[model samples]
Target: MKRLGRRGFLRMVGAAGLGWLAAACGAPPVPSPSLGSPSTPQAPLEVASPPPPSAIPSPTPTRRPLGNANVPGMYVRYFQPFYPPTREEWRLEVSGLVERPRTFRFEEIRSEMPKVTREARLKCVECWSARRTWGGFTYEALA
Candidate 1:
């Protein structure tokens, strides 16, 4: 499978004394549903507790299930099952400090932009760490 670039990370960090809290990946970002601002306080992100050993699913044709793997395919670490958003529904919203906030569709980030492949880890305090070929595009490229 082809790789996709990372999008939306820490953007507005500078000498400006205003100090508006905004986060976009300084290098590559994995923009989720929402990253709230200070005006309306946001609850700390909540994640499910670690899954038991028995919870791990049997390997399918594509995945080995858990731990680091250099090959393609992904493992699900969540306790409950989930369906990731299809390309049509997923969006990356670039808001805050910028003069014009914009929403990027899947194609704009995955196809129109250049892609990069690198080894990276997904560390979570609530669960085990997983590694992958972190495919991401620079945040500045979107502009």
Candidate 2:
């Protein structure tokens, strides 16, 4: 048997915990098909209808206003070590199978590109969600 490292063991435990959580929070179980005698037909199972749209509460953000980078809830996860670079030394590398390959400085990108803002909603499979206002220059702006 292969030995699992501390990180691997932790990841496996985390996955199992998530699986258990999902199982615990799952929808009501469906009734199994009956194997009753062919002579007697099983009665049709009735399902309860969901409440109307009006009865359901809206999930739109209202109580708290949208937040920025300095917001308390904002957090970062670095899978790898991060090293900050000086603005002058840093360059946006754009390369690959393209007609023209170029590297642009942070200052150049900021000054020359046309910027746009977009409202983005991030949702997870576990039902966790977040909304953010993202602002950046488009591909056309970079071109």
Candidate 3:
């Protein structure tokens, strides 16, 4: 086998890490006949001539323009990672060296806790940076 350099190894590891992260936050796509889902009976394949240039539809803008607040994250996703864990299943537990110990669920926390949003930059060791909007309640808020 050929020897792998540090750069090659790191690249492979980073790709794998991203793949794992994607999987962890992933869910099966909606079953469709086009996708040949196991439950769906697939149609036999047919070779057809390519459509004429005019017959093809031109690509149109289907999404709104990205704004400053729309910074993409490395592990970015608009959907909840769980599928997701129901609001009742996600718990924010507080304990140890606190006056009152309490476990709050997602909805409760979101409804009760004060939320903060600020623009911040995340600098990676790989020598790149990106602005991110951080939103969350603090420990003091929890207290």
Best by TM-score: 2
lDDT of 3 by residue, 1-143 (tens): 99999999999999999999999898877777657545644997788999999999999868543333333656443665557677668887898989999999888888998998887876655445568788998878888
Give per-residue CA lDDT, model 2, range 7-113, as digits (tens): 99999999999999999999997766674435554887788999999999989885444332234354555699878999989899788976788899999989988
lDDT of each: 0.67, 0.77, 0.78
lDDT of 2: 0.77
The TM-score obtained by model 3 is 0.41
Cα lDDT for residue 79, candidate 3 = 62
- Candidate 3 has which clashing residue pairs, if any? none
TM-scores for every candidate against the unseen true structure: 0.40, 0.44, 0.41
RMSD of each: 31.4, 17.7, 24.2
Clashes of each: 8, 0, 0
Error of 1 at 66 (Å): 15
